[model samples]
Target chain A: MLTPLTVALAVAALALAAWCGHAAYRDQPTKDWHFAGMAVVTALSVLQLVVGVVRLARGEEPADSTVIFVSYLVGVVCCMPAVGLLSLSERTRWGSLTVVAGAVVLAVLQVRLYDIWEGVGA
Target chain B: MPERNGDTDGSTGTARAAGTTGDGGRRLASGPGRLLVTLYGIFTVGAASRSLYQLSTRFDEAPLAYVLSAVAAVVYAFITVALVRGGEGARRAALACCGAELLGVLTVGTWTLVEPSAFPDATVWSDYGMGYLFIPLVLPVTGLLWLRRQPTDGSERTDTTSRTGTTGRTDGTGPAGR
Candidate 1:
């Protein structure tokens, strides 16, 4: 079951990805706006991790807790930080594009997490 | 490749005005290079972490595939570092790693297809990187191509100088049209 919050977050992530891709080819500097979007996505991902664990603890059955938890944790910890660091190093429009790539990866992981929750594999 | 007085001066001034960044010794790596490096970093971390988790949990079930995943992870890590480093040393390392990756995906991808029984489950290159939308397969080729386009001396031989008339593109690729 997809929640409104999750859907909204996914949309935002996708939007960020699109913007980053557009900015990369432009060869402009990635101003603060790109970072801000990444920061927001990071916060939402953290929230999702908390909520996901809580749901699992409340006698909820998932397809595989191990895979689900790992995907969530990695999405939160690795994707955002890596993107941030890469963007800073870029110092160009491509920096923003890096952020966008991270967002898309994060969003895909989010979908994978949801699939894990449903236990479709089971 | 040769160092200039203004370039060694450590200012975006006459150095960049003369056309270049990070000292005239360094050439314009370009926005695309940066973007490509960023993507490689993401994949490096993503693939490495996933492989580690998979290996730690179920080594017994499919040792061959999981081990290959770990190898792929290491290769990606190497490539990421090389790409971001972006110098003579880094470029050579990156090209080598990219070449390895291309071979790996192709060989493993075909091996998996031919001998499905050998691999109980999927690896990163199991189906020619179907899991990653074939990006894993394509990235190496693209990386090699891009690296070839750059000067081998690890200097910014062509900065905005060649494209000065069109200042629209700072990297000398083309006008970005921001």
Candidate 2:
């Protein structure tokens, strides 16, 4: 995984989480703007996924077991879209809160992915 | 008061009945329950996949820990499904699962602490889910509280309805609508 891209994704996820959490506290459902924000995060995740795969295809091995790293990579990629769809079904402040939770999870997963990648060489 | 009564009676009777029986009542995936379901779903996936990978790849390293992780994953999956299905039966099942989850976490946590060598690696509940931000420790407690708050039988519904009526009479709009 690209270190800079991973760090960027974590920051974006947390920032979006905080934003959604504020919206939830204000008793607002996930608005269009929230979807847009999620889209940006999801786009970043997709980019990471593509870059990781491309690098792997070109003989770049992760620091650890390829299975575990690949699993986490897929997980990070899928997290936002799943949570976003789930939140869409809910039309209350809790929906926004769900987005916040999803973002937080995504951020954590990204950090884990980074650690796993780094763990192999160090 | 009469207007509020008429409105609730006309519109919400089915909703109330469904909520009570889980036949057609409010879905467990509705409102705040939605949030709970989402969290449970995440844990279900996380625990299940993690355990599967560990058990398949390195079972010899820590058999006990991997088994416990698998158990935790199953419990999480059951609870998630029960919460989503809703109804009295599902609620009871969820409550039971939550209770079991709490018991498991406490038991495993204390066991690991009292005998650190017992777990060479870590189960999901080892150290009360420290690796997972203690969510495994807190989640069951929250599940129990949320389940307890759900109206169970007819009597509870009547009690809530009466309370709604009293508030509606005084305020001219039932507080329950929101």
Candidate 3:
């Protein structure tokens, strides 16, 4: 049930997380590369939200459309932005680490979204 | 007060004092603390919504599991607030909640495995939060570890400095030391 887009997003997010985690352990600052990754994540998340809404409108039913859509919406529009802003404020290694962690969460939530769409659970 | 900079402000002056004396625990409250709070807020909303949905949809199906989800949400919410508020009292509260979260996850994880029938549905702690990729399990441990390493009073000074010579702080005294 995973779309090609989702797969690509997941890989990209994971890669960003790995890079960010490495940088964090090295006690580095929040690099421009990390911000670029977050921007990608944000863009992809918005795409996913739009896709979800379209699917719902097209009669594609999830196990719980309300919950599924809400989760996705929150993750993209609210949670991700808030985390990104806070990390920028910190401007430390831990701040970068937070971005890394948030990327991981975003990837996992994408998986969850896929499952919800397909009406399955692991 | 309005024109006073962060370092010079009398209100924030306590933070400087705390930093020098290792008592201004609020440093984290503003910086990395806010980031953590944001994450916790997401978890709080997720867990709370999930639990409420479970309860409203099927209270009779798995009361214990659903109730635990609600508890997890409350803990996340509390921790988020404590981290944002930033003070000795807030830190204490956060420490207690984080500790309880760790214990709760373990206990519920074990209970669910041993008594599957007891939990017809999944709680945040079920399967040691495998559903959440065990972040639930790891977060509290990290929070508690951070809390323990923090100065016992209310200051934010730790002795573990990096090579840069900056005082011991969470990020290892920046890249200058490295």
Candidate 4:
């Protein structure tokens, strides 16, 4: 995993979380504009996922087991889209809160992803 | 179903239900239930994945811990499913499951604390889920509070029966419907 990119992704996820939290505070559901933010973070995470996969394919070794690392990589990519869709179905401030949950989770996952590569806690 | 369904049994909810009954409909996953589901789903994945990896690669290192992690994962999964299913029955099941989760966490947390030597390594519920920021301890308590606040079908039916004088609460103003 790229450390800089992961950091950037985590920052973006937190930004999205804040944005969604604002919407939830305002008693509004996540609107189209919020989804644009979701797309950016999701795209970046997916790009990171691709990079991680390519590295694995080239027989580059992470600091730990590939399975744990890859699961987290794949899991990061799934968080926003799943939550975004789920939020779409909800149409309320809680829907916005749902996005907040998703974004925070993704941000945390990003940190974990970085740690896995750094073997910080492995 | 709105997460902020405060005074849900009062006249305010009766008035409010007129507007949101279509979506929330008193389902378990409506309103704040969505938040609970999100949290529980995340925990399920975290606990399940961790336990699976540990059991596969290092069971001998901490068999009890790994098994407890798996058990916690299962309880989390059951609660998630119950919330999503969303009904009086589902609510009751989720309520029961949350009770079990709290019991498990307290048991495991206390066990690990009282007999530190018994747990060579940490499980999710160790020290009351300290590794996970005590979320394991906090989550079940939250789930239980939320689930208890939700009006069951029978209670809602009794409520509606007196007010609406409706014979079919199954389709009419819900004992469960928002």
Which parts of model 4 have CA positions greater than 4 angstroms off? B1-26, B154-178
lDDT of 2 by residue, B109-153 (tens): 999999989799999899999988999998998788666666553
Residue pairs clashing, model 2: B18-B25, B19-B25
Tens-digit lDDT string for candidate 2 (A1-122): 78999999999999999999987777666667788999999999999989988988999888777787888889988888987886676655677788988999999998788878888422
Residue B10 in candidate 3 has what lDDT? Answer: 32
lDDT of 3 by residue, B79-170 (tens): 98888776677777898999999999999999999999999889999999998878789888767766555555543444422223322355
Q: Model 3, A13-62: lDDT tens per residue?
A: 88888988877677654555567777887787777678777776777677
- How do the residues A24-85 of candidate 4 rate in per-residue lDDT, one tens digit apiece? 88776677778899999999999999999998899888887889999999899999998887
Model 4: per-residue Cα lDDT at residue A116: 85
Compare candidates 3 and 4 on DockQ and give the better one: 4
- When just chain B is superposed on the true chain B, each candidate scores a TM-score of 0.74, 0.73, 0.72, 0.73
Stretches > 4 Å off in candidate 3: B1-23, B30-39, B154-178
Q: Please list the Cα RMSD from the true structure of every candidate, rounded to 1 decimal place.
A: 8.3, 7.9, 7.9, 7.9
Instruction: Tell me which of candidates 2 and 3 scores higher on lDDT.
Output: 2
- Enumerate residue pairs that collide in model 4: B3-B31, B3-B32, B156-B175
TM-score (2 decimals) of chain A in model 2 = 0.95
